[model samples]
Target: MKMQAEVIREGELEKRSDSLFQLWKKKLVVLTKDSLSLFPDGHKRAKGKELGFGSILKVDCVERTGKYIYFTIVTKDRKEIDFRCPDQSCWNASITMALIDFQNKRAIQDFKSRQEMEQAAGKR
Candidate 1:
């Protein structure tokens, strides 16, 4: 089934192995404001995996060697998903920017909610 998400950037990238011995696979990658999705092919029938920003602790540019730029997506629970894209593709940078924006928006919303709750408590 197709995922229902507001698309930020969608394209193809290589998901690399997290192990010391690396392997790469081409996949269709989807970046939303709040999550990243990867599908085996550019078709709806392909099985997909989703990683939400809420669980993502950080995105790191691990290394750039030769024509590939390696990166890692670390989750709050300490899980790391590694990926690599062509140096010219800039997929890593775009994903990082979108994730940072999402986090900033969330922080502002959370701060506003806390302030409103405190004001209500003071009034009571």
Candidate 2:
């Protein structure tokens, strides 16, 4: 069964390459409630890299220029990925909000599980 994730936003953003040249390339980004998918080309049908919210530590706004707002996404493995979008686009805020919502949902689930374990222990 394929899981359908709700789309929060979709737009084009420039991502800094990790290669030696560190060139910035425009990517087609699809922000979902649970993950951010980056398509190299404009075609969404192509294979893309999916960054699950579970592995995202935080999204930090690094700087803002007249043309673009720069941000970094820190992952669980401490890898930082840089991205930039037009200042008016507010991509940083969108990603941060989505990340917060995902984290809150995980926290709530953890709390409920702990409560259930406590109740079981009391019964025992």
Candidate 3:
């Protein structure tokens, strides 16, 4: 059964577009335990792109200006997606904490699976 992801934080964040202009577009972002969803229309019902935490390597704070805190999300494939939020929003910190939590849970699950495999082999 597929489990529903819990919402950790939801807010409006500015994402640097990959287009030639490299303009920053406002995205309605929904931060979940397992993924970050970007809604283009700033509505929950709108179709959005989901970036799973499993594929994300880390979030790096790139720059900090007086108005906004810029950060980059590096994916496993080495793709860097830039984002920014208001200085007080703490979006970077929120994503980092959630990502760490997801990674720790995955590590625990992997360790349990290895133990179970070893136990089965011993029984045989």
Candidate 4:
């Protein structure tokens, strides 16, 4: 499937799995205007996992210990996805900015819709 939005950034990052062991998997991460996509190494047919901005509630920078910076992406469903990468990569900041932009656009659209509804109600 083709993505309609432009890709903001693409790189590899260590994703912390939700399993009991909390294993870190190295996956290729692609950040677009609408979603984040993950792909396995050299995988051609797999679509991998896509996390849309609408389902993402917030992005949090948890801590920075030595070489790696820790961050978490919290979904609207209350699920937390953890990630850590090299201090120089700046993956955490990039993702946070993109998510914020998407959220702000969504908020503006919601406000406009609500205003239109209120005006229609007043007219009736």
| Highest TM-score model number | 2
* Worst ten in a row by lDDT for model 2: 60-69
Name the candidate, 1 or 4, with the larger lDDT value.
4
> For candidate 4, which ten residues in a row score worst on lDDT?
39-48
Worst 10 residues of 3 by lDDT: 2-11
- TM-score for each of the candidates: 0.88, 0.97, 0.94, 0.88
Model 3, which residues run further than 4 Å from truth? Answer: 1-3
Local distance difference test, candidate 3 = 0.94
Write the residue-wise lDDT of candidate 2 on 18-104 in tens digits.
Answer: 999999999999999999999999779999999999999999766999999999999999999999999899999999999999999
- The lDDT per prediction is 0.86, 0.95, 0.94, 0.88
lDDT of 4: 0.88
lDDT of 3 at 28: 98
Candidate 2: misplaced stretches above 4 Å?
A: none
Q: Write the per-residue lDDT of candidate 4 for residues 49-107, one digit (tens) a residue.
A: 98999999988867998999999999999888999989899998899899999999999
* TM-score, cand. 2: 0.97
Question: Compared with the true structure, what per-residue lDDT tens digits does model 1 show for residues 39-73?
Answer: 98776478889888999988985688889888999
Clashing pairs in 4: none
lDDT value, residue 68 of candidate 1: 84
Q: Summarize candidate 3's per-residue lDDT along 8-122 as a digit string, tens digits.
A: 9999999999999999999999999899999998998999999999999999866889999999999999999999999999999999999999999999999999999999999
All models, RMSD in angstroms? 2.4, 0.8, 1.4, 1.8
How far off is residue 14 in model 3, in Å?
0.4
Best by lDDT: 2
Worst 10 residues of 1 by lDDT: 15-24
